[model samples]
Structures are given as structure tokens and as C-alpha cells.
Target: MTVRAAWLLPEGQTREDTRLAPVTPMAPESELRSRGGVIAGGDPLKATGAGLMQLRIGTGRAIVQGTDAQGAYPIAVTSPETLTVADGDPQHSRIDSVMLRIYDGLYDTSETTTATVEIVQGAAATTPVAPPLPPASLRLWDVTVPAGVSAGVGGLDWSNALADRRRYTTALGGIIPRGWGLAFDGAHDGQYRDDGAAGLQRWNSAAGAWLPYPYDSGWRPLALTAGYGNPGHGMPAAWRRLGSMVMLRGRIAPTKTGTTIANGATIATLPADIRPAGGKEFAWASPRDQTNKGPSVTRVEINVGGTLRIFESHDLPSWISLDGVTYCTD
Candidate 1:
């Protein structure tokens, strides 16, 4: 049996490996560019206590780009790496960024191809901004160092001082962690992400934004007004939302079976979020006579204020069907 490694050319081939070389790096690069960040489930450079001026990075793996012109590559911190934080300025506070960097000798002759973590110290000011990252680096976390901060005498506050900047990505276009500057283009349309407090979200190229996924509010019973209630049949007045469209179902009738329905009588009301922008009319099935013998068509109106009313009825309907009522909520 023979085994061939990635980026290996056929025997006796003299051509450069640029074509095949990019294949190996492009997978991670494309993923990182479109959905890259730290891979979940690993410690992935978690910051922990070491000393007042130092932090310990737990073992983890990440994918980061070198630059727009350079391909992305994977970096692993198999063992914990400890880094020292520079002492703060005496008069002004500053922010410092902890970054994971990939150094390629091909790009910079001065440096060898290696992955390492470093701290980029920010300038001191009344309001300090984090320092910009160098080429081919991924920001792990930001530390706020107050003025006069030093080791031993007064340790850095891990709670308020640390800001997590780590985002996450997955293979095969699975759910990734969303952060600022992540692209919402057609290439990533239909992909899902975790937007921190916003919960799960999906990219929509047409709407040009990330919308909440499964955009559904499971079926809820419609709020019936006075003189109206759900019929005794299995079907009951219910409403739900699917994406940008709101749907209604079930049957409604007067609380008293033989009572006549009034023109423009309010039957139920929709929730604010699922209400239609403008008035809509739907044809519904209703009982033709007091005996509930045959079906007849009736007009139902849903107003902008979310009021559901019977618009026109030939005679008193024992019950009205709302099974097919649907309208856009956008």
C-alpha cells in the first residue's frame, strides 16, 4: 500500500506546488474568512491566573488569516503558554490585547514560520482603545490595565478587566460564533451562528442581515374577544409565525351557538409582533344555517391593529373556519 501526503507532487514532477499548496491552506482560510474563529470544545487559549502581571493560556486550537493576500492556517497551543503584561502607566489607563499570531518565514525573512501568543500594549489615555493586531494574528482577549497597576502589590482584576474577543468556527459550514466584521455575503447565506446574547442566527443575503433562525413562534391560542369563543370541535383558534409570515388556524364561533354574528364584530386579536402591517381579508368557511347543515363562504378581515372580525355573513354562522388565513408580518 502507498500513502500520499497533502501538497506532495507526483514523482519527477518539476512544477511548483502553488496549485496544490493552496488547497491545504485554503480549506481553513476559506472557513476562517467566512466562518473562522476558535474551534469550540477546546480550552482554546483560555486566560487564567498566573501572576498580577502575567496570564496563562490554556491549550486550544484556532484558525486565523495572515492577511488578505495570504492564506489562513491553523494554530494549536498544545501546552499552556504564559505571557507577561506590561505594567500600566502611572497617570493614565490603557487596554492591552492578547493575540495568537502565525509567523511565516516566506512572508518575513526576519521571522520563522511559527505560531505564538503575544500581548500588544495599548497607549495610555483617559479612554484607551485596543491596539490594532499585526498581520496574520487573531485577537484572543483584551485586558484593561488601570493606571499604576503592578504585580504583587495589587493584582489585575480578572473579572472586570478581561473582555473576551474569541469567536468560534466549525467544519463543513456548521454553526460558528458571530463577532463584528464577520461577512454576511451570499457565500455564507443559510449558514448559522451564535450571536452571544442574541442566540442562534442565520445569514440572509436578500435581506442583507442575520435573522433569527427557525423564525417560528410555536402555535399559540388566539385571544378571543367577548361574545366569541372556540368551537367544541377539535380545531381551535390558534396563531403562529413562520419566518416573516404569520399563519392562523382552527374554528371560531359565538359563545352561544344560535346567536347571529354582527358585521365587523371582533372575534379575536393577534399578538403585536405577528400582526399584519395593513388590513387583510380572507375567505373562510362557515355554517350556512342555524342547524349547521352546510358550508358557506364568509369574509373575514384582519385589521392593522390586529383585530380579527367577521366582515360579511349571509346568515348566522354556527362556526367559522380560519384554517388558511396567512399574511406577511414584515
Candidate 2:
């Protein structure tokens, strides 16, 4: 983490331009002018005088220090050699248009950019060494706190685990209380306007309430309909009410051992008492419609150990194992 490796020097400064040296603990302690030492009297072009040298240390990353006209060090005076620019030669030209540049290894060679620097004489005390930054750990998501932010809060980016696309449509309908039925439709809530019917509704978790969605013309919100048996029509009491969400908590399936059946094996002839635990294996005959689009189960086979085995049919051209897991096309 110390980024002291790169610096923004004036145009004329090269990697080894030699006007300064690396600031080491052994180097005599020179106070950075309240700003960096600066020389105001001479033309910046002709004078190698110091002022703007942007220093990159660590976290929250930029620093400015330099010398002034009177020379009473405002910014500490350091040997130029200590500053290192990334791609450009330390030997840079002193042209006004030139920018001192230094780059950390964050980018490839194609993106080299010059850094900007400002120098001041005795403008401030020695730049404070920043405290060590906690190493950043990348999680499934990264939250961002915009500028002018306060303590402990940031906007969340949940997209890392969320779907990118969603589709919707419109359905003209009336509200029904929970568990009620519709006149021409089906059973809604039992009472005329009791809760338990169906209509547009939202869950108000804090109040443990189910608020009715506005049905004014042109106003629509996401909705949940009743199961195939019940579709409540306009009974206000039957309006859909929010309820506790049901969460079916379960763990991933337990691991199972698999035995592959070799070619020419048959599984249909196995005894009905065959246990799946043993190494029984078999392959099935390829299906006739054979576009390889349909599923076919292998015949059950019995190994010497009394275990049951079944062949797995796979895609054509490759005959890879489809494994016994059931698949659905809907």
C-alpha cells in the first residue's frame, strides 16, 4: 500500500531527473513549507523552482506540498529523485502545458495519464501520514456511498444476485376478501367484506396489515391471484389481506453415491427387492423417436451384491450421463 512510488512532476522532470531524492527516515528532516517549497519570482519555464508536486501516499489518495518565493519552507523540500512518475521519464520538460504524471499499477500501459500537483510554501505542516487502510474485500456485492455522505449508510446494489429482466401484463379484475369466492367465479372470503379474498394488495410488514391497492382507472400495481378454485370479485371485505410469508426452510439434498453402468448391461431383469446402495448398473436402449429430445429410463439391473442399478440415457452424438434426476420442460 504505500503509493509513494508514483508522482506528478513538471514536464522537465524525468524518472532520474536528480533535483531530489527519496524521502527516507535517514534523510535529514526538512519541514514541508507550510506548503511545499516554492519560488514565485522566476518564470516557471526557466526556473527549476518547486511548488506543485502531487504526492500519492495511500488511502483517500492525494497530497500537495511545495516551496514559496521567500524560501522559508512552507512545504518540505525533498530531493526530486524521491518522486517517481509511472510511465513518463523523470526527465520532463518545464512547459506550462506539460503535466507531471505518475501511475500506480492499476491500469495497463495504454492508460497512462499525467497527475496534477500544487505546491505552497509553509501553507501547512508536514503532510500527515495516513493511517493504514483496511484491506478491501470483494463480496458478492459492493455498496456505494455517494459524495457528501454521512456515517454508517450507503446505497445497496443487490443486482449481483437478482435477475436482470422481468416481464408484466395487465388484468382487469375486482377485489375479494381472503378465502371468499366470486359470484360467477368461485368462493371468496366467507363474509361479505371480510378479509381473505383476492384483489391487488401489498404486505405492510410493520403494521402486519394488507393494504388494498388503488383500483382507480389507469392505476395498476403487481398482484397475486387466487388459486385455480377461487377468484373473488368486488367484495370489499373480501379484499386480499397480507399474511405472514411462508418460508420453506430446507438444506441442499444429502450427497449420494453413483454407479455407472457399462455398455451391454441390462437393468430390467433385476429383482424387485434390489437395494440401490450396492453397485448395480445398466444401460437403456436408445429411444426410437431418437431426435434425442425425449427421456428414456434404463432397465433395472442387479449386481452380485444384491444392489439395484439403472442405466442413464443421455444426449445423442455424445451419450453423456443424464443421471437419474427428473427433468421438467415447463
Candidate 3:
């Protein structure tokens, strides 16, 4: 056996001089960075229009496997490709598949090395299912044909009949597509993926799952009960969530200076979603008055049910500080 490497030609050699073999390995090398799928952008392999027993596939670029020895290759569809849909079974509904196929004459022993769109007709039975894809093929869409459907009679109901089977991939180190979630075997841990509707997600090897990106909820004003109001300062009673932790800040006072705040009086209620898993208590500083003598402390309780209350034995202070009050929501 002999070994052949590419691009070692001396100066004055044109690209054709290399027989394009040097460039052939480039695509497969880059394609291996990402799991095989359609490149994300511009309605790749999208179903543009449908008619009776027919479907049209829009322009797209996809990477798919070639022969095991040949590795992977890319297929580009510059123009719309129309495919014929098999007539539906008269007795039961059946699912058909639209596939993008590659045929390399050198390796596949075909007349020409080319890529084409083909339809794999499903079996008609009481419980019909989509046909399995052939070797060197990628499924672009799954089409459902109801019983007794035929050409030139009625068009397929695209909304209900077509299912998008196209997944996406990007340059190396970019967020992987949602469809390739299970394809990675914990080797790509710490990498991110675009989870479509769920937004961005990160792979966790330990948990063997994709976790949502951490986020912080901006501060929102806390709804104070009757008689309790902002202390007329810039800092108003507010709460926010930072990942699993919830933080509270601001100061609250009675609407009137002389208003009597009974012991264990409710100050405000926390939103149900940000409530703590268990009851929590915090010691907060309160303004000192003649009745309280010197600096005083107030006990603030945040119950599991989201009630925020204050406990004090002596007369209520002018204002209570809720700043520096933080707890874990979990």
C-alpha cells in the first residue's frame, strides 16, 4: 500500500494540477466539527409549495455522510427541487419522506457522482409509518397522505400534512442545533446549543442533560399592603431573582407618621413565583424614636406562602430597612 498526501506541489502548479483531491479532504474535515445537518439560514430545504401528490423543496446547503471510507460531504441545492408524492392508500393513511441523496460514481458504482432529491414511499397498512431513510440520505421532511388521495383532484393540506425534519448546524464552537441533542455522547460538555423555543441551553455531562442558560430577573417593585408605602426615597421596596437566589431591597413606612402598626403586621406580599421554599427571617434596622430610646432592630419574616411581615414589641419605627435581605428560592 502507498500513502498519498495533498497540496505538496511545487510553485507554478494550478489548482487543477492537484486533481482537486487536496480540496476534497477540506470539506469532510470542516464538516466533522459539527453533527451533520442543514446549515442554518434562509429557509434551507423548506417546503415552498405543495400540490396534489407533489411537493417543492427550496434551495439549501446540507452536510451528509458519504461512504464509510469516503467520510462526509456537502450537498448544495441552488434551485428549487420538485418531487412527486406517491398516491395515498385507499384504506389507511401513510407517511412518506423527502430525502436528499448523494451518489458517487467512483464509490457507489453509479453512472455519475451527483446529489438529488428523492421520495421514499411508505408502506400502506392499518398503522402506516414514515419509511426509513436509505444509506447516504438525509430526511428533509415527512409528508402525510390521507386515504384515497390522488393527483389533479385535491391538493395536500400543507399545514397539517407536512412536518419539518430539517435540523441546523453552525461553524465550529457555535451553538449546536436542537435536533442534535442526543447525538453527542457527553463529549461536548460545556458546549451550548440553540434549543429553538427554549432559547439557549448548555450541556451538563454530570446530569446528562441540557440545562437552560442562567438569567437574572430585573428588580420589580414589591406590592405593599394598605398603610405601608415607600419611604419617599429613591429606593422603593423591590425584589428580584438572580438564578436560584432572590434579593430584596428598599425601605417601607406607614402612610401616616402616627399610624399604629400592630405586632406581626403584614407589610407586603411576594409574588408566588419568587417565593422561598421555606420560611425565612431577617433582622433589619429600624429608625429610633423617643419610645424606642436608641437604635433598634425589627424582625422581618418571609413565609413560604409569600407573606412578608414585621414583628416588634415596642412602638413601630418611622421606617424599616429591607435592604440586604436575600434568600435562596430553592
Identify the candidate with maximal lDDT.
1
lDDT of 3 at 201: 70
In order of lDDT, best first, we have 1, 3, 2
lDDT of 3 at 162: 90
Question: Which lDDT values do the candidates have, in the order given?
Answer: 0.71, 0.24, 0.70
lDDT of 1 by residue, 53-167 (tens): 8888887766666656555665556568888988889999999999877666677564554556888899999999999988777898999999998985686987788888886
Error in Å for residue 183 of model 2: 79
Q: What's the C-alpha lDDT at position 159 in model 1?
A: 76
The runs of at least 3 residues in candidate 2 whose Cα sits more than 4 Å from the true structure, single-residue gaps closed, are 1-19, 22-96, 107-330
Quote model 1's TM-score. 0.62
Q: lDDT tens string, model 3, 175-223?
A: 7666633454323666677766868777677777766766456899999
Score residue 262 of candidate 1 by CA lDDT: 79
Better of 2 and 3 by TM-score: 3
**Which runs of model 3 end up more than 4 angstroms from their true locations?**
1-33, 66-70, 104-112, 177-187, 215-283, 286-330
Q: How well is each residue in 1-330 modelled by candidate 2, as lDDT tens digits?
A: 122222333244444422232222111113322211112222111212121222221111112222222121111223231222112112321111111223322332424433322211111113322122111100110112122222223221223211111011111122222321222211222112223344555334453444444311221121111211111222111111113211111111102223223433322222222223443444556563245467654444445553323344553221222233221111
Candidate 1 lDDT (Cα, 0 to 1) = 0.71
Ranking by TM-score: 1, 3, 2
